[model samples]
Target chain A: MRITCPHCGERDHREFYYKGHALALERPSPDAGEAAWDDYVHQRENPAGVTRDLWYHEGGCGAWVVVSRNTLTHEVLGTQAASEARA
Target chain B: MGNLVAKSPCKGLLPLSVGAMSASEVETGAMTMLSPRKGQDGALDEAMRAVHGLGYPAPSGVESAGEARAIWFGHSSVLLVGAEPGQRLEEHGVLVDQSDAWAVVRLDGPGAEDVLARLVPVDVRLCAFPVGSTARSKIGHMSGSVTRVGEASFWLMVFRSMAETLVHDLKSAMEAVAARG
Candidate 1:
């Protein structure tokens, strides 16, 4: 459950806020109409198994991160800063 | 409690008169007016107004107007934990109870996540968790805000009444994790 933050060293779970999923969904254009926007905003596939998620460290440096965890067991497999994860 | 003048025949609190019965006032903390002479930073003030719709009056004797945020710890109190709570918090309209209505719980160390995992379903891993993030969630049945203050520490604001309950739960969970190790 303890994930080491690259900037803040090792921290406990209490300091981090859970942001759902690491997948970045693009917003549909305004011309795409209400249905397209609604579907894009409301519809998402919530898989039950292993997945990557977004979380915020509200207390730390205010950075964004992505975590890979087991859905059923709630075990965090790995975590990476969203910025670092990209590069 | 000058505000108690409206209600007649009050049972709990003392009535608003010289000869009125001295009754215990209802505890209403959480919204502590932590105003310094100086107010919130521009960015934080905007965020407070935009987010929580709060603006507290400046507390006397505080030279620095530290940054403020509109943070909800429970159902009743919306804490403005800084010099100024928020830009929109009406100082006059809303009652600001400067009493100690909340208990701040700081959770740090590597075992902190392991401790919280016992109750909170959300993952507390760093890679996914970002700093300056806030969540309205339940920690051991008490609904409150879990604000990440450090890479390893988070500040939990809970009702004073449930302070013992939360601490007990947190300790139990930590012990369980240690036992597993």
Candidate 2:
């Protein structure tokens, strides 16, 4: 698999470290309750189709990138810098 | 202070030639890392131009003015090579001395591209990675930077501690390419 890093251009997947789900960026408030914390920490959709996830470009430009891809086909739909994506 | 001497990272390990290719340790004088402050990108570029007569390089680009070269290090960072950071540059960004932090080696010859191709995953052919192009990639499991400096020459830099490993890897690849002749 190849991941197109926004700063480094397309590179082999070996250069990046996959961090599960883009939802990791959204953190629930401390007073949001136990169920919310549990869902945020332990739950995942595990869908079969398109998914957005975080990847650290460990061997390249050292950017955290949000990669949108189809889980079944492993085809990358698009990628954006985590900073820009968050904005 | 006690008497001390500075030794190059690749001391006695470089200036090696295998067939038509050669690798040598380069004297990278006073490397400085420049990282712009928040919302100071324009100011930093202006300072760089004023001080070094060169602007901050674009992503994966290298800009040179006389002996000074600005290499795109990573996101929002640049490495100034062969020159000292001026005081004016400090107003817009942080400048850290990095001269002793890296080992720079120059690979030159007809087989230079072929030797690097064996270790790095990037396409380093002249057509793909022309002169003044740079890339941060894995060099035989070690994260390093490769910059095309000439038509048949490249500058490769790795952590100072990895000098031996880098030379070993390059030597092996150089020998393999030579054996094919």
Candidate 3:
């Protein structure tokens, strides 16, 4: 697989590490209940279709990226810098 | 106070024969990493231009004037070589001393691209990489930042700790390419 990094352009997938879903970026409020925190930590919707996931360009630009892709076909629809995605 | 001496990471390995290509360490004094603070990219770019007469390069771009060059490191960061990153940029971002953190090497010769192709996965061809283009990619097993500086010339930077390994890898690749000729 090849990932098109915003800063590095198209690079081999070996250069990146999948960091689970992008939803992991959202954390529960400090005062939220245990159930809320638990859900945030353990709950993951492993949807087989299109999903937004996070990947780390550890071997390349060292930027965190949000990749919108199809889980089944491995088709990447788009990508954005994690900072920009969060913003 | 007593004086201190400078030592290169590729001390004995440099100037070594690598077939048609030669790998030499670059002494880039005062290398700095600049990352713009929140909502300050414009100000930082302006400050950089005012101080060094060079603007921050766009993504995957390299801007060089004389011996000084600015490499786009990531979305919000740049690596400044040759010229010192001025203090004014501090107001807009953080300045980091990277001179010792990275090892810079210049691979030059007619076989430079051939040698690199064996180790790097990116397309190093002139039409694909082009002069003044930079990218972060893997060189062998280590992460590297590569820039096409001139025809058949490339500037590669890797973590300081991996300098020796990188030199060895490049040498081996060069030798293999040379053997094919």
Winning model by DockQ: 2
lDDT of each: 0.54, 0.94, 0.87
Off by over 4 Å in 2: none
Give all candidate RMSDs, comma-separated: 12.9, 1.2, 1.7
What lDDT score goes with residue B109 in model 1? 65
Q: Write one digit per residue (lDDT tens) for candidate 1, span A15-71.
A: 678877675534577799989888777877688889887877554435677788888
- DockQ scores for all predicted structures: 0.06, 0.82, 0.80
Q: What is the docking quality class of candidate 1?
A: incorrect
| lDDT pick, better of 1 and 3 | 3
TM-score of chain B taken alone, candidate 2: 0.98
Clashing pairs in 3: none
lDDT of 3 by residue, B1-181 (tens): 8999877777777876666678888888878999989888889889888888888789889877777788998767799999877778889889998988898889998998888888888999998899899888889999889999899889888998999999989888888888988
Error of 2 at B78 (Å): 0.9
- Kindly report, for each predicted structure in the order presented, the TM-score of its chain A compared with the true chain A: 0.71, 0.93, 0.92
Report the C-alpha lDDT of model 2 over B83-119, residue by residue, as the tens digit: 9999999999999999999999999999999999999
Query: What TM value does model 2 have?
Result: 0.97
Lowest-lDDT window of 10 residues in candidate 3 chain B? B12-21
